[model samples]
Target: MGSLTVPACVSTVLLDIEGTTTPITFVKEILFPYIQDNVKEYLQDHWQEEECQEDVQHLRLQAEKDKELEGFVPIPVNEAEIQQIIQGVVDNVHWQMLLDRKTTALKQLQGHMWRAAYASGQVKGEVYADVAPALRKWKEAGIKLYIFSSGSIEAQKLLFGYSIEGALLELFHGHFDTTVGPKVQSESYRKIADHIGCSTESILFLTDITKEAKAAKEAGMNVAVVVRPGNAALTDEEKASYPLVNSFEQITLHPVQ
Candidate 1:
């Protein structure tokens, strides 16, 4: 597809992190592996914490529901059974991460694990070379910037706050997670526009996923598919349907109304 131009009326920019601003490797290679490596240890160490216990309880409930559907007998809640439950929750988390499933519980647990990693300087978030400059330019141009990702809000903040480019968290006005709704749902885009206090037409959403672009477009938001290294390559049809840009340098935002 030919070079795509940003809409002139766009006053807000909603961005996806992985494959859009950040490299896919940073997520799939670094973040996911970190979570998988630390999840069991983190869970064991924090089992007494209220928040950790809550997440474990949620996982247990989900496991029970799954077992019911499979016609398995429920485990009684006893001392020995609680130990089994903890192990079950740990196994379930690892399974979810393996499948890359987006569950609130898993995201929350990952966020907690990442907090220590980020704080300890074991991991720093990665973004494309062009991303920081583009973000700064857009912010200077009066375009409101927001992040919409499947990662929990805490995780989102930690990534940007400890990013390789420094605290880019300041550049973003707000963050959205699955808590707002799933990214593929058009209503999620509409809800983001509402949250930003702008007309859907006045916000530009950038993402690597074609389905996400279609959903944003369906919600009447301007959308552009961001093509980056390690991002899933777009089909010819997808490229034709949505505006596609290889870099943020190609994006041109109009003055805020």
Candidate 2:
């Protein structure tokens, strides 16, 4: 592919993590399992603390909302019952119930637990071969690169910094997590533009998901849909509507008008 035309103003590149820089299965399977296996006990052991109490409240509120949304209601319960309920929610991958207000606590705790696994050689972060070299080349060309992922910024940093190829965080200028907003929402991309102090048109958004690319495009950003091998599930219309590439090597920045 040739360089894309924007206004003569593009200056930054914003990339997503899972399925873009990292494999999506690692997140959905390995990382989520690691988090789920630990959260119940982490919460149970830390329940008396103020932060833990807050997270419990969030879990309870989330559970209630989730039950209601699913056309059911949670019964009022004792502490033990609530613990069992929360554990069940996590185990079943009821993300709507487990990942909301205060989900950061669980994600952070999971990150800490995962550190040992990564350090002791039990796990390694998976990255596509194209990502690291492309990032370095972009950095060398004086383009500012930022990470926008659903993963916590700390988690993002850790994944890149401890990558199988080793500390690649040096290439990224900044990171954003769900605290900014959900990846599929236009506000998230807007917030990233504001945070970067650049016009949305000056930033190029790259991801494997169409909805996310749509969100960024709605925020006035140019979007690239990365079609990594056997990783994406784009619908038929998606194949015709955007710049689709098999690797970052296909991306070439054009000077904005």
Candidate 3:
């Protein structure tokens, strides 16, 4: 597709992860599997740590609420034998992941695991070649850049902080996670604009999901649907509804004067 110019009024650019700046494969194939395969070992190793215990407590609470759900996996209480508790937590995590659930309990543990993995060089955050340079250019142009991903804010930081290109956190003005709201909710976009001290019309949101694009548009922000290899296919109607870009290089941002 041809270059797409962002609105001249856009002063802030909000980005989504996974299929937007990073390849979906990295998340599906690398990051998540790292959690599933290693959660048992991670728990065993970090069981004594306060943070790990807190993560387990959260999962336990979430499991309590999920008791009525089919195929719910219960996490054993802390008083249980160490092995049983670890196995319970491990099974619960695997169950949540298999069903593609995005519970905060699941995300919190995953974030900590990913942090260790990234810090240990066992996994590196992957971004498209065009991403870093485009971010740099936008930053130089005085466009405030922020990330809004479903991942926990800590996880988001690890991805960019330990990215293949080295730390890129400096490129962003701030970050937002699902704690603000679900990505497909227009109110979330409005809240982000309010937090950024910008009008909705003066911000641009880029994502691989049409639902999110529609939500941002509903909130009066400029929107773009990002197309990346391994991203889910967009419908023809979606293509017609939003500006599409296969690479960040195709997006030319005109910062507000």
Q: Each model's TM-score, in the order given? A: 0.87, 0.73, 0.94
Tens-digit lDDT track of model 2 for 83-107: 6755653553335425443444345
Against the unseen true structure, what C-alpha lDDT does each candidate score? Answer: 0.83, 0.74, 0.92
lDDT of 3 at 43: 95
List candidate 1 segments past 4 Å from native: 1-4, 68-78, 81-88
Which window of ten consecutive residues has the lowest lDDT sum in model 1? Answer: 69-78
Highest TM-score scorer: 3
Tell me the tens digit of each residue's lDDT in model 1 across 21-51.
Answer: 8888998889888887777777778878998
Per-residue lDDT tens digits for candidate 3, residues 150-245, read 888888889999999989988999999988999999999999999999899999899999999999999999999999888889889989999999
Q: How accurate is candidate 1 locally (lDDT)?
A: 0.83
Off by over 4 Å in 3: 255-257
Instruction: Show the colliding residue pairs in model 1.
Output: none
